[model samples]
Target chain A: MNLLPGFDDILAAAARIAPYASVTPVLRSAALDTLAGAELHFKCENLQRGGAFKFRGACNAVWSLDDGQAAHGVVTHSSGNHGNALALAAATRGIAAHVVVPEGAVRAKLAAIERAGAILHRCAPTQAAREATCAEVQRATGAELVHPYADTRVMAGQGTLALELLQQAPGLDALITPVGGGGLASGVAIAAHGIDPALDLFGAEPLGADDTAQSLARGTRVTTVVPDTICDGLRALVGERNLDALRTHRVEVITVSDTETIAAMQLLWSELKQVVEVSSATVLAAILKQPQRFAGRRVGVVLTGGNVDLQALPW
Target chain B: MNLLPGFDDILAAAARIAPYASVTPVLRSAALDTLAGAELHFKCENLQRGGAFKFRGACNAVWSLDDGQAAHGVVTHSSGNHGNALALAAATRGIAAHVVVPEGAVRAKLAAIERAGAILHRCAPTQAAREATCAEVQRATGAELVHPYADTRVMAGQGTLALELLQQAPGLDALITPVGGGGLASGVAIAAHGIDPALDLFGAEPLGADDTAQSLARGTRVTTVVPDTICDGLRALVGERNLDALRTHRVEVITVSDTETIAAMQLLWSELKQVVEVSSATVLAAILKQPQRFAGRRVGVVLTGGNVDLQALPW
Candidate 1:
């Protein structure tokens, strides 16, 4: 389960991706801060490449390969942001990319990946099927497999964001993000805690997809087949490596209802005029649902992504 | 029709409101640049106070009055951004702000103005009615009239943005914006052409409510009554003074459809992750629809505002 060797991986990723990724602004929400009784600093990863933070890892993973390995290409399976991100990173490096997307994935997302110059391959709905198909493609095409979160390189790359955040907005009382497979949350916890052990790490999860919450209580990594959350970006079950990181780091997991997430999303749009994806709303929803937990603290939340289909906004 | 005299007025206004308005970021959109076939630089006034560039003028006007006039306070007729801007500005300067808002204005906008501590003066849903009511409020309270446009101070204040834009991203091939009352567009044309005589200026108007287009073509000012357009912020006619400025400056006016505006807005949301109002989308719509004109050019567009009702995005 040791994905990263000390903090060296985080440092390496930071150096490698320095020229490519945007060091997005850490925005303070006066209205949200006043309402929540906490000073909320938003690390606006929604403004990241492919309109999501997924780009950081995707970019690093794509760029890390040696020229000989890169010539063979890279592959991943993602519903939206990751696919678009990998496609963009691959395009940036002039390398080939193969994305395994489930059938009936949002057409806009599929088109976006294609528009970014990725070769798309359709797979079955189930995770097992997706992994199998991705494996087959990787073997057949001789492309390097870059798992979205579970890979060491990807986790290392993702942790660089938290490193940047801590360096930029020091003394944050808490670091929070929406957790699906836990790559981002794990990164945040490691980076933030490594910088300062007092920094609290929290994961805002959809109540419908509360496997992480249940698994933490059960003291084991668990899987769920059917997740009924509108936050499509947060649909994955906690992987073994991420779940281990969560336990070792003692991450606090908060669950928010879909209704609350939509409410927070609507509020963000009205107040900030930034149309963030539902997953981004999860942090605000968690704070709104239980203000006492975050009240009067310097809270930092990663606006996970803005890759939601505008035509398909659930609200 | 000379409401504001040359660049002197804008310079003075800039000095007056120097401490209030935010020097918003000029963002570069790589994807949008490719789509428009131009080097696109966005003057992100969408991130300004009150979430629109209107705040600059409102803040200046509210703060520039003499001590006696400040005590008497300020009054204005606006449906949204202007009201909030004036209210916030007045509050900052320790003055009363009476806002005459037409009936059926977005509830969120009304709430925002109220939160900023403005006295609400609800009026009938018509420009004439709103103005009459605003006059009544002004007379009764002896409040200084702060017309949304058609005022010397406001125009000068609005011009400051263009001055900043020119300074920040100088040597633009052209400057474009969604023209409503023409306050912003007029100021931009003045600053852009003033700084660089060869800088081209263009105005984007909604086809459904294109009084500016007609006015420019006819060489006279025109007015519209409850004109229909998804760009709710661009329904105002080009005022007499602003029309004269546009004509004198030889600014090109282009009209775009609501469908095009929505598509442009969605494109920014998907690619740039910026939730701009429909009014701001006009510039993008214009550039996208007429790529031949913008291709290979260094173009600058004002992202005029970001205060759209996210709960009810027109898309």
Candidate 2:
């Protein structure tokens, strides 16, 4: 078997997740294009099932299990889109989902996960506590652990977005996605490159959470910095498999400041009329930061999610 | 010519505005459907040019003019979507657009209109002053006056949305739209009924500005109310032609409270991941308030616009 998730894995994942996930629409904004000096085709994953592209991976993982593995159900430690996506995906399969949510997680997000039938296991906000809680829950329930962005299956599922996006907007010169745990970026880089070798793949990172950029620059996974970005969805460190995929596929990770990300987020909201989270806006931020590189080209941007606090708007 | 816009007018408008206006997508949200106890197919006009369905009418009017009329350009006294839409439409035709904006109108909206290439003529915040200013601009520029909702051509253009929505979602049981100047509702009622005589059409109005409801009830246009609603777009009294169409088509206008409209707007933003203005939420508010009337049926809803002041969000 191939070490990295091959093109076939993404194709299979696309087929597996078809009945469960949404084939979200591709959106365009002339105003935004003028700002970046590039024609952008935004894959609106914010409109995906559970309001994020995370559903694709979660759906794939929940349905890919063998009969015995399925009977035990699935569990994950997450406090954002991945947890909610997994809960909803498990609900569709009528399987138990245990979400190990760290303390101080957004109450609205946790409520949404619970609403999707996930049994919440709370722990201290630290990563160690989250891992310990997830492990304990896994041991007690004999549940299959599905890491948010580390597993090959999950990465393959995330790559399905590129498959759909490439089909929707053919002849895209470059593809840009915000890197979180690097699952989406790695998956996109692998699948997009596999489909068209000439396509330039880019990963956007917040300066406050620039481990992915740091790792790529150092040629090693970096995980020492404490993230301090408004893009809550992209605060996770780059996963080992994700870093490997990025390196192998030659994906360039560009970093932008939180202020720039927020400005891009407002531009997307005001100009595109799209309700995307700050993390998703980072892709556009990266494009604007180096407009000369993408000028007059057809660029594809992945809008990762649209879950935001209504009362507390960043603008 | 017929007293009201005919089916052929809508068809012609559809073709006329196709190049300029978007055939806005029909979106669905299961959570919103469950809340209203009905399956709603939302015609997302909020995603239309100038961020509202008003663009369809404006584009049609601007393009429909003869050589002499087109040379003179188009003029309107709108402090909102119609003004911006007309400006953009005129820009497309390489003609001048003179917009008469009131003093107290939204600063962001005014800036957008200016950016769209409309020559702004500011007037007092009263009706007589606005009309006087509009007439003066029209006289000076020899521009054709396009009433926001009263003109037959404008109404015909707005009807094109219904034509598109019906084709997108075949066999709809009913259709609903928020009534402000009555242009959208009048056009929708005419087009929807022309397509399917049996289809029920409903209009939503905020109680604070229930002139349309009163007009439909008392069988005569009511134009003497001091409007007081958060839906700035829907505060205008029913127009003469709009009242005629609404009466002829037998459209029912349902009144909702500001509280209800706000709640529905929040629900739409949270569940549908759509950033629509409060005016657009009135349709869902009406459905939720009278679920029994629409339960277990497929309804087409027109989301009017997405232009709202982010700094002063109702939520």
Q: What is the C-alpha DockQ of each candidate?
A: 0.68, 0.68
| lDDT for each residue of candidate 2 in A110-206, tens digit (9 for 90 to 100) | 9999998999999998889999999898889889998888887888999999998999999999999999898898888888988999999898999
Q: Which stretches of candidate 1 lie over 4 Å from their true place?
A: A224-226, B103-107, B126-128, B223-226
**What is the C-alpha local distance difference test score of candidate 1?**
0.84
lDDT of 1 by residue, B173-206 (tens): 8888889988888877776676788888899999
lDDT, residue A169, candidate 1: 89
Q: What TM-score, to 2 decimals, does candidate 2 have? A: 0.98
Residue A82 accuracy (lDDT) in model 2? 95
User: What C-alpha lDDT, on a 0 to 100 scale, does residue A26 get in candidate 2?
Assistant: 91
| Error of model 1, residue A75, in angstroms | 1.7
